[model samples]
Target: MGAVMGTALGAVRVVGGRLGLPVDDLAVLKDGSNLLVHLRPAAVVARVGAVTASVRGDVFGHFARADELSRFLAGRGVPVVAPVAAPVREGGWVVALAEHVPHQAERTLDSTTFAALLRELHQELAHFTGDLPARGPLDDIDAVLALLSRPADLVAERDAVAAGWPELPVQALHGDAHPHNVLFTAGGPVWNDFEDAWRGPVGWDVACAADSRLLDRAAVQRAYPAELLDHWIGVRRLLVRCWVAATDRYRAAPPSPSPSP
Candidate 1:
């Protein structure tokens, strides 16, 4: 196993054991930007920011905010994956324990249903009054550019994109509203991963969910102007590229001191 994955697994096992949850059957459910571990024989899943820790300045704070938002959504009858407990700082990793709902990872919802569900989520999110970064993912660009030593071409593109950022009505958003973040459970499609939650233009969320084959672009355009959607879509694309570059550079660098919790 890779060092990051091994460390994440060990941390979850330690945290799970401390909480009196079973660890004998602990298994990794997913390992991507972050690690999702199922603390089995129990319904708890641990979200370990293995890779995210490298880029985010406050990994614990990030997960804590997500946990808070999930609870809020759950209390309001939103179909969101709520946390089982608060985020725990252990072994230099931030671990969030949440209810592990069984889901069909390969299931795909039709465009109409998908768009409608996303709209429902947005409706609820509008009521959230929590503190969130105003610019959303756009706020991460400077830090990521710094990590990549300010690539000339990317810096120019970022500047151009920043100049076009719209001034529109803002609300809490599922910052990363892609189809993959939706879990198709028997109960229904439950949204997961609020780590990127932010207060920004609703268009930002719309653009995030506008996967060509998964959501009808016309449906999205009806709610927000097509021009605005197109702008946010371009911005989202740029942010994605910046994050990819940052993750690569962060991973390639030598280990650094873990941030204080």
Candidate 2:
């Protein structure tokens, strides 16, 4: 296992022990921007920030907001994975425990269904009155660019994209509303991972949903204004590239020196 995942596993194990949950069979469900470990036999999962903490300065706050939003959405009858407990800061890692919902492994939703579900999510998200950043993931482009030492061409592209950001109607959004984030459960689609939730144009979420090849672009486009969706799609592409570069840089950097005891 990687150092990051190992650290995350250790942290989650410690938290699980405190909560009286079993951890003997702790299995990693996913390991990407964050590390997700299934606290087996307990119907709980731990979302541990890995590379995400390196990029997002307020990782703990993000996890807390996600937990809060998940609870609110669940209460409103939205199909969302509810947090099982409050977020815990342990072993220099932020871990959020959530109900381990079983989902279909191979099933996929059609474009129309996916679009409809996203619309439903947006309709409910509009009612969220919680504080969120006005800018969405695009705002992180600046930080990623800085991590990459601000390449001249990429900097120009970033500035151009920022210049074109439209002043559109804004509401609480599922900031990372992509296909992988939605699970096809026996109970239907359950949305997961709201750490990137922010208050921004609905187009940002629409752009995210449409970017996936698993969905029909035409069907997704029919649900939103083509012009707005197209603009944000381009912006999302840039953000994706920046994040990839940032992740690579982060992985290549040497560990920080230990401070004097």
Candidate 3:
């Protein structure tokens, strides 16, 4: 698929001459999910390329919807990926671009640096929730319903807890906040994957971050804000457990929502 798209793009470049932008293939990185590429004009102004590409991402939302998020994050002063030139208009398939955030690797999420970044992210998220459509854990429940196991009571639980919790914030959110989704740069940590930005509780996102076994638990607890940590761990057993049932790693047995004969 990568080769096919590259070839077609090359063909277009040949026909359009200078107008046909050359797409530079950025070879596979540590994570094998994206097909990295660079887009540039015919003019020679070497060093920095204006835009970078990641073919697809699980967190990406519809273009217009995503635009709202990208802009919102910028307004809130969060370090999320910056949207590049408007998405190239293509029917059926879509390609989105963002300014390449150059950064060093910090795979370990337990460092004080990481903890500080998380604090910043939560702060920004708190601000982010004030501007968008307010949603609750209930929204996530619907999507993962078919994929979960022993999730029969999840819906009821989400409703009650959400009622007890404060209203969902409307500000721009990373939607899927996870360690890997965050990248470090000279400016600080930048969150990637804006597809899931929506008006939902930090409840689920924070839970996923703190509960990730891949991360150093002590470091997270030591560093995260008291309120943030409280909410994250607060819903871990119920929401996060339900999320696990929805994930591919689990053999989901989401109760059949069927009518009895």
| Candidate topping lDDT | 2
Query: How does residue 221 of candidate 1 score in lDDT?
Result: 60
Worst 10-residue stretch by lDDT in candidate 3?
44-53
Residue-level lDDT tens digits of model 2 in 1-261: 767557678889999999999988999988777778999889999998766777777778889989989999999999899898888788788888999989986777887788888889989999999999877776688877776778998899888888898988889999998887798987789998999999988888888889987887888878654458888988989888887877786677723312212
For all candidates in order, the CA lDDT equals: 0.81, 0.83, 0.49
How many clashes (backbone atoms < 3 Å, residues ≥3 apart in a chain or on different chains) does model 1 have? 0
Considering summed lDDT, which 10 consecutive residues are worst modelled in model 1? 252-261
Model 3 stretches astray by more than 4 angstroms: 1-20, 24-66, 75-77, 105-112, 125-133, 136-141, 144-172, 225-261
**Candidate 1, 105-205: lDDT as tens digits:** 88967655776777889889889998888776767777688777899999998999888777777889898987888999999899999999999887787
Cα lDDT tens digits, model 3, 75-159, are 8776667765444333222344556667766654554566667656656666544344345344445445544442657767766
| Model 1 CA deviation exceeding 4 Å by range | 222-227, 250-261
Error of 1 at 215 (Å): 3.5
Task: Let me know the TM-score candidate 1 reaches against the reference structure.
Answer: 0.92
- Which portions of model 2 miss their true places by more than 4 Å? 254-261
Cα deviation of 163, candidate 2, in Å: 0.9
